[model samples]
Target: MSGIPDNLVGLHKHVKQFREKNDETLFEELELFIEEEKVRRKLVLERPGELFFFYKEDYIVVTEELSKIPLTAEEFTGSSSLLRQLNEDQIDMVGQLTKELVILRSMRMWGSYLSC
Candidate 1:
C-alpha cells in the first residue's frame, strides 16, 4: 500500500534492516526524512544566495522586477562561523532578509520611474 516501488528490493531490505536495528517503522523513518528534506530545501534555495519566491508577492506591485544579478554566498555579511551557529529556521530567515534587501535596493534605483 505504500508508495515505495515494488522493484526496489534492495531499498526494502535496507528499510527492514534499519527497522529491526532501530525498532522504528519504515514509515516513521520516511516521515522524518521528508520533514528534514522540507526544512533543508526551505533553508537553502536551488543555489547558494539564490532567491526564489515560494508564493505570490502581493505586497509589492513590481514584484517581477527582481535583479537578474546573481549573489554569491561569500557576499553575505554574516560570517561563516556566525552563520553556522544559527539554526535552519534562522538561516532561512536570513536568506529571506538578504533577498528583500536586494529587492529594496533595486526598487530604490527605479522608484522614480514606477512613481509615474
Candidate 2:
C-alpha cells in the first residue's frame, strides 16, 4: 500500500499469476497482506457511534440518496465536462484517482473473501 500505484498494478499481476499457478506460499502471503489491510482500513473507517459528525450509517444513507439525485452542469462536473477543461496531466491524474477509487470500492466489497 505504501508503494507507487504502478507498483501496485505489478503486485496485482504477480498475485494473480500466483493464484493461477496455485501457489500456497503466495496464498499465505496474500492472506497476511489482506489481514494487515483490513486492520488499516478498520482504523480509518471505524469511529465511535457517539461521534455525531461521522456516523457511518448516515454517511452510507447520504451517499445512496445523493447518487439518485440528477446531476446538473452548475452543480456538478461530469466526465464530459472534465474532458473539456482538463490538461493532459490533469486528465491522467484524474484517471489514476478514478482507478484507485474503483479498486478500493471493489476491495471493500470483497474483503471478507480475501481473508479466507
Candidate 3:
C-alpha cells in the first residue's frame, strides 16, 4: 500500500545518514525556536535586535552583524560565534527607551512654543 517506488533502494539512505550524523535534539530545538520567532514577529510590530530597528530621535542605532544579516536560519545555527554580541532583550529595552526619549524631545519642542 506504500506509494513509494519499489525500485528506490537509496531513498531513505540520506535521511538515515543525516539523522545519524547530526545532533537531532539540537536541530529540533533550533527548529522550534525559529517557529516561535516567526510567530512572535507576526503578532508583534517589532522583534528587538533581530532586525535593524531603532528610534531615530535618540540617535539609537541597532543593527545585526554584517555577516549575519544575509544568513539563513540554518546557516546562522550552523556557524559558531556568529552572533555572540547581540542581545535581543537588551536591544529591545534600549529601543523602547529611545522611543521615550524621542517623545520627550517632541514634547519639549512644543512646550517651548506654548510657553512663548
Find the candidate with the highest TM-score and give its number.
1
- Model 2 scores a TM of 0.25
lDDT of 1 by residue, 1-116 (tens): 12235564456555533645454465576676566556546555545554443221222212222433223345445344433433332543333333333343354433432232
Candidate 3, residue 23: lDDT = 59
The lDDT-based order of candidates, best leading, equals 1, 2, 3
lDDT against true structure, model 3: 0.38
- The lDDT values for all models are 0.41, 0.40, 0.38
- Any residue pairs clashing in model 1, and if so which? none
Task: Please report how far candidate 3 places residue 67 from its true position, in Å.
Answer: 34
Candidates, ranked, TM-score = 1, 2, 3
Q: Considering summed lDDT, which 10 consecutive residues are worst modelled in model 3?
A: 52-61
Instruction: Look at candidate 2 and tell me the lDDT of residue 102.
Output: 28
TM-score of each: 0.25, 0.25, 0.22
Candidate 1 stretches greater than 4 Å from native: 1-10, 14-24, 50-116
The parts of candidate 3 lying over 4 Å away from their true place are 1-22, 46-116
Error of 3 at 1 (Å): 43
